[model samples]
Target: MDTETVILGGGISGIAANYFLGKDKAAIIYEQRDSMGGLCDNFSIGAFKFDTGIHLSFTSFKEVREVFDMTPYYTYSPEPMNYYKGLWLKQPIQNNLFPLTPEEKVKAVKDYIYKPVQADDFENYKCWLYSKYGKYITEHFFLPYTEKYWCERAENMETSWIGNRLYLPEIDEVLYGAMSSATPNRYYAQEMRYPKEGGYKAFLKPMLSKVNINLNKRAVKLDSSHKLVEFEDGSKVYYENLISSLPLPALIKIMKDVPSAVKEASENLSATSLILISIGLNVPQDESKSIWFYIYDKDFLPARAYYPGLKSKSNIPSHQSSLQFEIYYSRSKPLSMRKEALAEHLIRVIEKLKLANRKDVLFVDIKNIPYANVIFDKKLYFNRNLVRQYLNNLGIQSIGRFGEWDYLWSDQSFMSGKKAAEKLLNM
Candidate 1:
């Protein structure tokens, strides 16, 4: 097969790139899976449905809004919480210290009031946390949660990816939150949106109509020197331009010949894999109104979890509720137990936490996603740039969260594709 342009990976990024490339341009998307949507896709356990992970859009990008508005969606206020020893603190734990004991609260406030002076440059994420948040808060909450979530020590990670993700409160704000449980939602997004009926994949339905995609076609080899791609199914495609949304390391491996340094750099780029445990309940849940919450306790197993049934009533059958837990692992933190054991542990912990009853569980479904989020460790900056530069020199444009190897939301991934398409048009 031959085309003017070929896009690898059928995720949001590839879809957006094809859409923006213009219908006049000849382009095709080759996806390894039998379906599209990539990470934004959802699964089903009987009538209960669950997204890959918590995928809510809070983007203000005009282009993204214009495209996403094609489908019906539900708008929700960001009501995320944090689970400590037993108390439920607000999403930004630093800003909601009222749940802590009186003595602990005093120590936290005092530490913040007399926190150390800011340094010229932070040694790592750990240093940044200690300097911004006081020693008490950092050691008690941030440090432990960071290790569990990232599967690595905060001292070994970089802070470049922490833009607006963590809230840094003023003295008065922290004091007020400590005095009372009532605090304004300080999450980065004022409102979050999700499809009203179908899972997140519905948002990209319109884009799917505009692009031509070939499912079950996995690209196994690339002859960049001759501008050709070879698929595992013995299909060959010759293209004038290639846009790749595959992981950098996987992309590097398939190329005909790569420099040793570039290959090593690709190998060094780190990412987290996810194990999603979806559960369906026979009855509705009224315990907590939070859409999602973080787990600081190591015994919980999952770093975070969300109520998929709450996102949309249509997600579950009548009088039923659901929960989806995200357990992340990487080369640094290997899974301590098998998938079945992990699922069992999650059920036991939730019951122990009194969030759910083991008897009410209707079914449990687990899915393994190889690429969840890119880890911004110390080696990420230099290594990622090196691999990206090499691909750029070969006239290959990489887009999307995995393609770009960065922490990108759904909207950001869409915009990445738009940018790649624009660049191709200009060229």
Candidate 2:
């Protein structure tokens, strides 16, 4: 079959690309799963529901907000917390330092005030954290937590991807926040919105009607010169234009007739795989005000977890709740794929922190996502540029976080898709 355009991956980017391309373009989305939404997809355990990993989404951009506005959503302001060895502080521990001991606060404030950070062209994520928050906060909280989450030391990764997500408070604010938990605004996303009923998929479902989506079709091979795609079911289709949101490495591997240099560049591109541990409880959360928390202790597997019921009451059954945990694992540091073994380990952590009593547990669900976040280290520019240039020269437009090999959230990926479609249409 022949078409004017064929988009790969039903993720937000591919769908968004089709949306911007308009009906005259005759575009179709080829998705491997039996559904659309890609990373924006959601899952359910009994009556408890949750998004993939987005505890909350905050976007001030008008263009991005339009998609959410299409669906009826609930606006919420959450006070997320952070857990250290034994003390609890607010999220982005640097800004909310009041929970620390008097002695600890003195050290943090001293460096935050007088210490001159070693400024230079950034070397890695570690250096940036040290520069911005000073040595005291870096060593105690920033360094350890990031190390657990990223699967590598901060010194080994690049710092350019630190989006508006991080809250770096000024000296006066830090001083003030250190004194009281009822401190002034410090979170980057002061207010966030999500679907009143469904999880992330609710916001995504409205956009699907704007595009033609073909589900359960996987792209096994691509003939760049012929502008053809070969699906796993042995179907082949030729297209005049292509917009893809597949992971960069997987995309490069599927294309026919690639150069050695391009292949090498694809190998150099790295990403962290994700393992989600969602636990349902017969009990309610003690701190009903907290939407989620940032775990800094090395003893825990979860980098973070959110109360699904807290984000939306409909996600849980009456008098019952759930906690969704995100634990990132890579080949470099793989966690037990065995569910029972992991359950034991995770339960130990839960009881240790008193998050959920083991007796209160209902059931545990484990999901492994092959592509999570891209590791943006020092070699990012050289390697990403090489692969992207190769694809662009061959008339293939790669977009989205995984497609472009960058650290991007939902809004950024949506915009990237729009930009890619614009680029192809203009051409």
Candidate 3:
């Protein structure tokens, strides 16, 4: 069979691209898993629905907004709060300095209000923090906490990735907003939206419906030289235009003849592993009223935790509530020892945080997701540029979070796919 475009991986991007390109192109999406949605997929136990993570829609692009409109989602307006140092500080902890002690608050205000010594060059992530938030605030809040989450030293990561993703308030804006007790609806999607029925999968389902998708099909090999996609079952599919949302590293390896340099680059690109542990409670109560908690302490096995019911009531039954804990670790970390050992360690941490007691928790649902996020750094930039240059030369376009090695949300992925398809149409 011949098609105008062959999209690999039925993730958000692949579906969005196929939809934008329209039905005239005869687009076909080949997905490895039995279903679509990629990492955005959800699973259910009886009446309960649990997503891979708590995803909230906050897009800055109009095209992205339209893609979000394709789904049936209710607006989620949670006054986001943080659980840190035994206190619940308002989300964007920088603006809510009141929670801190008088001394700590005064120090933070002074540092934020006055500009630090300008650097000759924006050093590493840690050095940038020192210059922006000063040593004390950086050490207390940003450094250790971020390190725990990313599983790499903050200095190793690049600072350019922070562009608008992490809000940095000007000194005047910080103090004025804090003292006035006002957090303007200043977010890409500050008042983000979520599905009212299913989980993250709900949003992706609509886009997939418009495209010709093949499920339970894994692309084991690719003859990019001949523009052929080979599946695990020894089936071959051909395409004129190809867009892939697969991880760039793994994608590079599937090529019929990858250059030595390209293969080396793929091997160099690393990612932090993620394990999501979902705990359901027999009793119905909002133990952690805050939508999510970000922990910097190594003592906590999971870096962050969020309540599914808080995002949407559809996630759990009326009489029951559940919380999802996100634990991040490098594949090399000791915590990746064994599932049994990791689960025990996670339970102990929950007890320490007083988020739950042993008896209240009914069962633990553990999900280990590989390449949860593409690691962004100077090396990643070089690797991606080289890989993309090679793939582009091969007439293949890589889109979405893992495909392009770009740190973007599902909405961004959708828009990227749509844009890539539009580009193909113009061509």
Per-residue accuracy of model 1 over 277-352 as CA lDDT, tens digit each: 9998888856456889999887788889898877888888888898899988899898868767877898897797
Candidate 2 lDDT over 144-224, as tens digits, reads: 877678777788888778877678787878888889888765677778888888887787777787889999999999998
**Per-residue lDDT of model 3, residues 217-278, tens digit only:** 78888888788888888888888999998898878888888999999998888787788898
Q: Is candidate 1 or candidate 2 better by TM-score?
A: 1
C-alpha lDDT (0 to 100) for residue 411 of candidate 2: 85
Shift in Å, residue 327, candidate 1: 0.5
lDDT of 3 at 17: 87
Alpha-carbon RMSD to native, per candidate: 1.1, 1.6, 2.5
Best-first order by lDDT: 1, 2, 3
Against the reference, the lDDT scores of all candidates come to: 0.90, 0.84, 0.77
Number of residue pairs clashing in candidate 1, backbone atoms closer than 3 angstroms, sequence gap of 3 or more or interchain: 0
